[model samples]
Target: MIEIRNLTKSYGRKNALDGLTLSLGHGVTGLLGPNGAGKTTLLRCLATTLAYDSGRVEAFGLDPSQASQRTALRRRLGYLPQDPGSYPHFTAFDLVDYVAILKELTGREHRHREVRRVLAEVDLTDQARTKVRKLSGGMRQRLALAQALLGDPELLILDEPTVGLDPEQRMRFRALVSRLGESRTVILSTHQTEDVAALCERVVAMDRGRVVFDGTPGGLAATAAGQVWLSDKPPARSQLFWRTADGRYRTLGDRPPGAEPAEPGVEDGYLLLEVAA
Candidate 1:
């Protein structure tokens, strides 16, 4: 549903996206990267909000540069940017209702059904009348997600969606996303490896504005297959181990002669990429 070819973006002399080329088909795909990894830049381009200096980007076969085609693409695209905020005077219901109108500009009363359904879908029906300022952080995030789904969009691009959410809320949001992925393309950008492992059918790892890895969850796990391990004590080379709260450690590289195999996880694979970069 998303395609980027030789896309390049520059902020003065610094390059944010450098000749990046990748194609995304239908399903949930995680755009994984560290801070300033061009994940946002790429998403903005795909969202048709930010223009790139060079190269071509197409979303569902519609070129972003074409004004006539852009609106059609927008009709099918849903985006939940990080830190999406609501106006102080707008209630949760009001905010969602507004988005519903934009999704179907002339529907008026017909849009009300969409607005109500989305509010309940995100479990905000109880707080529908409350002003945005009164809702808790998690509620606002849910509201943002509700609006993203307001259009029954075929392609959803969410950036760092789970940030600031509590564990329970995060799980619920993940479940919602998983449900959406069953029929459409859901592209999410996040640095949290576990988030990708949880919901995405494929993971795309980027660093320094370039894609370094793009594959299935199992393929990602294989990156650190033999590199993750556990030890009775912290290894002398402590850089490889991630310290745990229970006085245990998860280390990378060949285990010491007597050390047994430790459980490999998303973070282990993540670290392998970090180390490689």
Candidate 2:
């Protein structure tokens, strides 16, 4: 549903997205990256909210750079930005209502119905009248998601949708996002490997504005299959090592002396990749 080719973007001299080429289809796809990996820049460019320096972006068979096409594309998509602004004075319902209007839902009754349905989908129905300032971080995140679900768009782009959410809330968010991706394309951008492992069938890892890896979650983990090990103490030769909850050291890289092989996870593969870069 989306095609990008050699997409390049920059902020002054530093490149945020450089020679990034990606294509996405139906179902959920996770975009994984570190702080400067350009995941957000890619999302903003794809959402038609930010212009790129060069290359092509086609969404739903239209070039987003063109005014008419971008508007048309936006109509068929929903976007939940990383920092979705909140109106302190507006209640949850009011905030979603405002977004519905922006989406061009003219009929009052129909718009209200859609808003209610979306709020329920995100489990924010109980907070419908709660002011934005009064809602907890998790509740506010759900409210942002509610607005994104207003039109039941075919393409959903969520940037860090689980941020500020507790474990229970994150689980709820995953369930809602997974359900939404059943028959549509969902591009989820986040730093959470567990979120991607749980919700995405395909995953892409990015670094320094470029695509580092793209494949199934299993494929990602496979990159570190023989490299992950566990030891009683931290591995001195390991590229990355951390003390586990059980007091053992889980290490990735060249296996250390007395270390036992451990099954690699998505995060393991990702860290190994970043370390290599």
Candidate 3:
């Protein structure tokens, strides 16, 4: 579990996180936000990879601001950053093994077992021996995930973990994350609304560095209830209308005369929230 209160972080004059307060328990919670919405900043703060300008952050009853507690918190959490960076020369196994050691896996044989286990979990077993530079983008992303899964931490912070993944791999990741969430807390930050709809039990939307909405996936979709309508053509003067796959115009705004009310989904509500913000 994690708790935050009035957490604020800034980069010079820009506030990355502004008076953010949140509590997370065991389950998959999707963080939905557009660029510059502070999702990554919040995740980094939770991971203790970045320090905030103000407020408190505690995970599993330990304060991450303290040196000793920060170490302890790190031991109980796994983080996959937005840009995991490149390890060009290291093989997939080596990359994970390096991180496992950092996570304090001291025994060689045991560490190797863990490295292979995590690699397999990410479906990168076949490329375990391949060099990082030679792996495909998706394979490299999975390799980053392998390092994050090194110790089976209680909390997992994933920022754009599905980036570059094919549909099949994304489904595999959803299944794995869903299974993990049964016992621990997983905070998944992504732009992919479909993933949130499919995997997250709770959804949190942020805008301009603050929490805008927090609720269940269905509840999020319901935020757009009665606001979404379908028509053969977009409503004149409507700013939020898009062509759908069915050749109909799906518009989110005040209803147009004769337009049919369409069922709202997670993305529809999220978009409406963004526009309002």
Most lDDT-accurate candidate: 3
- Steric clashes per prediction: 0, 0, 0
> After superposing candidate 1, which stretches have Cα over 4 Å from the reference?
254-258
**Model 3 alpha-carbon drift over 4 Å, by segment:** none
Provide TM-scores for the models.
0.95, 0.98, 0.98
Candidates ranked by TM-score: 3, 2, 1
lDDT of 3 at 43: 97
RMSD, one per candidate, in order: 1.5, 0.9, 0.8
Query: Candidate 1: lDDT over CA atoms?
Result: 0.85
RMSD over all Cα atoms, model 3? 0.8
lDDT of each structure?
Answer: 0.85, 0.92, 0.94
Give the per-residue lDDT of model 2 (tens digit) for 128-235: 998999999889988998888878999898999999999988898889888888999999898899999998999999999999999999999999999999999877
lDDT of 3 at 40: 98
Per-residue CA lDDT of candidate 1, range 158-239, in tens?
A: 9988877898888888898999999999999987788888999999999888999989877888888878776668787547
- Write down the TM-score for model 3: 0.98
lDDT of 3 by residue, 207-237 (tens): 9789999999999999999999999877897
Error of 2 at 254 (Å): 0.9
**Lowest-sum lDDT 10-residue window in model 2:** 233-242
True-vs-predicted CA distance for residue 117, candidate 1, Å: 1.0
lDDT of 2 at 200: 96
